[model samples]
Target: MTDPVLPDLWLDWCAVTGTPVDRRDEATLGRFVLQAAPSRKLLNTLRLAPLATAPAWPPALRGDATALSQLVHGGTSRINDPDVHWITRLRLRRLVFAAVLLAPANQGGLGLSRIQARGLTPGRLQSLRPVIGRTADEASCPACAVWSWLDVIGTNNDWSQDALRALGHHRDPAGGEVHRHERDDPSHGWLDWPDHPNLLPAIDQWGYLDRYGSLHPSSLSSLVHAIETLADARIAPARPASVEPVSAPPRITAEEEAAILARADELNARVARILKEYS
Candidate 1:
């Protein structure tokens, strides 16, 4: 799914506020200011002038007294309506904070950190799927969590280990195969990665079970297709050997490997930048 319209909304706000743009440090803060600008009067009263000027705001905004104070005193302003200022400031602060937390980070420049990355792994991914059955509203609930996990994988660029671990597998002590059978009932079912072709169907199934008490037929079909595709890709044999047999396997040039790594690194960096901005 594409990101929510909040970033565009925030951009509109920035245009109205005449806020300065800093490409380097203030990218996130610029977004916050634009997003929060609709409530400019309240923001002014709260003295959240710094938010208007901050290069990057925290991904989550807390509503404690300290936050309140920072919002009100951060910027300079001539408005002095104390009574109205305090009430509007408090109300606007809560509203803005809630929007920030609930909004999808990828769509904007918001993202989870390394610590947050740990919670968004595959094991946790399934737990969120059950919520989809509750209602169409439930789809987004699981999606948000799943997207967070994807973001972690995409940003880290460590598909072999981190990605596998996020998918609920760990190396066994005796051998290097993925560990299984250690978990309880529902989680135990997810041990075989190849069994399920893609993660989307499982996500849909989770939603259906959580919301409707049964899986939809179409959803099941989708899951089957995904699994078939995965299996086919995995078991497919490599291309046939050349007509003439060679003494040894062809060696990859250092330049070629370096180019591939560079490309991968660039892609990861781009993803990371987007995540940071939206976060």
Candidate 2:
């Protein structure tokens, strides 16, 4: 059955349906997340001063297809298609990143190398993944883990991989986070970050924003369609060609072959005779 409105958190929706959050489209959560989104008000209310300058949700987010379409030319396309998914993924990613950038120094950015955002193995990533109430706190240090947004959405494909990895993060084999200069950073070296320093509180602000974006109907539906597309392509990229069996020619005996060769010789001789006679 189709769901009318998406739950406040992706995990909440997953829990109700008993489906993995990564495979959200399989849950049948229904049409679009037409309800509450850009849960920015929750983050905005943070009394911190550094976040006072971060950009707020874009106005285009609230309107209907027509208004949203104007934000990016393809925003009005069918929800199941890649265009609309792109619209949801990109706009939402930007929205959250902008908010993080504006967050109070303690809550958001840390001198920790932004490079920690890259090369996260899916296993380690899952360990860091956040649920509704616990999203921001999944990582021990919110500042060090500020780049979680990249891992949440980036690992799937080339475009997303590049966009998120561009903001790179790295860790030592001991799970210690490392910060390297922009010019020297390499994609190869990193390890699972340890849970130590557990000093920072949960990044509730980011958690709220992530759930808003991922649980939205647009994001979930696009994921389902994308999975189906891949499956369809694998099953049959095009119609399969039909095969027909052929009967073996009657076996020819040695005598029959000799007779055929004799016949051919006879015809050739006759033709040659005729040619000579004509000449």
Best model per TM-score: 1
| TM-scores of the models, in the order given | 0.19, 0.18
| lDDT value for model 1 | 0.28
Q: Which regions of candidate 1 are displaced past 4 Å? A: 1-250
Runs in model 2 with CA error above 4 Å?
A: 2-212, 236-279
Index of the highest-lDDT prediction: 1
On a 0 to 1 TM-score scale, where does candidate 2 land against the true structure? 0.18
Q: lDDT (CA) for every model shown?
A: 0.28, 0.27
Looking at model 2, which ten-residue stretch has the lowest summed lDDT? 71-80
Residue-wise lDDT of candidate 1 within 128-153, one digit each (tens)?
Answer: 23321111221112232233223222
Q: How accurate locally is residue 76 in candidate 1, as Cα lDDT from 0 to 100?
A: 9
